[model samples]
Target: MIESISKASAVSGTKATESFSSLFEAPAATLEGTGATALNGETFMSALGNVAMQAANNLKRGEEVSFDGLTGKANTREVVDAVMQAEQSLQTAIAFRDKIVNAYLEITKMQI
Candidate 1:
């Protein structure tokens, strides 16, 4: 999967770079006192939700493709690719969940 992703980025070249930069481009606004920029609550939550949904969709697609392969609808390569991608996504989601849980625990241990 990493090889495929690298090949894809290589194929896209400058277009991929432009898209990546544009996607993460900073907003213009800054906080009143801190002068630091941050995503507003709604925007942050929406982005997080979108990521979660995408992962879920990927996992579902992988399952569907596996079933299709069993039914002779999808080929071996397609099923393998989908399954690998889904596994990667699941690992990422698990890592994120672990980080969040650890952060919460740390916060609880902090002195107010």
Candidate 2:
């Protein structure tokens, strides 16, 4: 029974990761008028903005779901999913920040 439960949980986790990934795939219709029809057409600044917005939204969702869970309005699975997504977003943002800081330091060390 325990093995079956663990397997089921693993499958669900895989599905959640897939769904999360799909959220970042902008539909062609939405990109049509923005001049970013292709993935490469997106500018760095716009991509950064989109990532920031997504992170903010994920954290917000986690908070909301947590509150709902406390009030008995949300199920455990939903709360867990939201929190996991928010944590992933935060870690990604932190990683981005670290890379930017390292790049700045590297630039500072370069000779004029």
Candidate 3:
């Protein structure tokens, strides 16, 4: 899956600078509550929800493709590609969730 991702990214040359760490980064918090300033917790949860939804959608698509392939209505290549993409998306979403959970755990450990 990693090899396929690297190959795809190399061909596109559009996602070169984005590392895995950046995917889980919490966006900058505003100094004061004002226009365009979303609560940091809300923003993080929104991001997490978006990524999870995407991963779920990918998996659903992959499952559909697999079923189609079984029925001889879709190409095997489509199934393989969809499943691979779903796998990568799921891994990414899981990693993001783990990072958020770990950060929360660390914060809870801090003494007042």
Candidate 4:
């Protein structure tokens, strides 16, 4: 029973991540009239913004799942999955941010 539950969660977690990532497939679409070059610079910021939004959404979903689990409206397995996914998303965002900061520091350290 435990193994089956874990397997189910693993599958669902993958699906959820895929759906979230799919949201960023076309960041430039909303700016229909702008030249593609303008969008090129915006794309990095847009992707970062999207990732931050996803992390927030995942954390919110985790809270909802936890509440549901507490009230007996959701399965424990689901709560575990939601919380785990949220934690992973948060960690990834933080790491990405740290990498960006490090890059900025390195650039600033250059004599140029």
Candidate 5:
């Protein structure tokens, strides 16, 4: 799922130079209590959910492949591919979740 993000600036006449760190940092808080924003929580969760679902579906396909007989409705390559895809998707989702949780914990430790 693509999240629509819009950016605007009021630079006078020069180009702007920004680093990648700017993308990850949360906005500074102010007096109005409106600056504590989540860092792509919805998008990240959506992506993680999608990958997990795909992994589960792939595993089901692998099981189906086995049940369908190796010569009738499925082949060895198909089963192998399905299993590999499921494994890779599961690994990726785990890694992403770990990274996000680690980032949140690190931010919580900041001297703010």
Candidate 6:
């Protein structure tokens, strides 16, 4: 009886292993369909232009508030808010630029 049980257990283990192996094997047709989109220069430049425009807008608003005065023309809080927004926008733009430069340098160092 012990021998019979051992044989049954081995058969079940073999079946389980076969099923697990099939789970990872991709169909040939599925593999053929998988592809990657390539990034190009236009997309990169457009994204950079967007960030610069946003930063410029923020600074322009801050300047407008400062020039118009905080009396009745503009609320004291509005001027302060504009200035803070401009500062944050500029800082974010600078950080993003640094990150992109670092990535470019790292990629250039990689082997083909």
Best by lDDT: 2
lDDT tens digits, residues 1-112, model 6? 2233224334435767567445545555555588633244233444555677777778777878877764469888888999899889879978997997898799899999
- What is the clash count for each candidate, in the order shown? 0, 0, 0, 0, 0, 0
The top-ranked prediction according to TM-score is 1
Q: Write the per-residue lDDT of candidate 3 for residues 1-112, one digit (tens) a residue.
A: 2344234334323453244434544455442333455454464434655666667778778878888999999998998999899889878877986987898799899999
TM-score of each: 0.66, 0.64, 0.61, 0.62, 0.48, 0.56
Residue-by-residue lDDT tens digits, candidate 5, 50-101? 5656656665666677667566787777777776776686577679779878
Instruction: Give the Å error, residue 40, model 3.
Output: 15
Residue pairs with backbone atoms closer than 3 Å in model 6 (clashes): none
Whole-model lDDT, candidate 3?
A: 0.67
Ranking by TM-score: 1, 2, 4, 3, 6, 5
Mind giving the per-residue lDDT tens digits that candidate 4 earns over 1-112?
2233234334434767567546544445554555444445454545666677677778878989999999999999999999999889879978997998898799889996
In candidate 3, how many Å is residue 41 off? 14
Give the Å shift of residue 99 in candidate 3: 0.6
Ranked by TM-score, the better of candidates 1 and 2 is: 1
List model 2 lDDT by residue over 35-96, tens digit each: 86666666454576678767777888898999999999999999999999989998998899
**Which residue pairs in candidate 2 have backbone atoms (N, alpha carbon, C) closer than 3 angstroms, thus clashing?**
none
Candidate 6 to truth, TM: 0.56
TM-score of candidate 1 to 2 decimals: 0.66
Worst 10 residues of 2 by lDDT: 1-10
Question: Candidate 3 — number of clashing residue pairs?
Answer: 0
For all candidates in order, the CA lDDT equals 0.71, 0.75, 0.67, 0.71, 0.55, 0.67
- What are the per-residue Cα lDDT tens digits for candidate 1 across 1-112? 3334334334435775567445544555534455866655344434655666677778888989999999999999999999999999889878987987898799899999
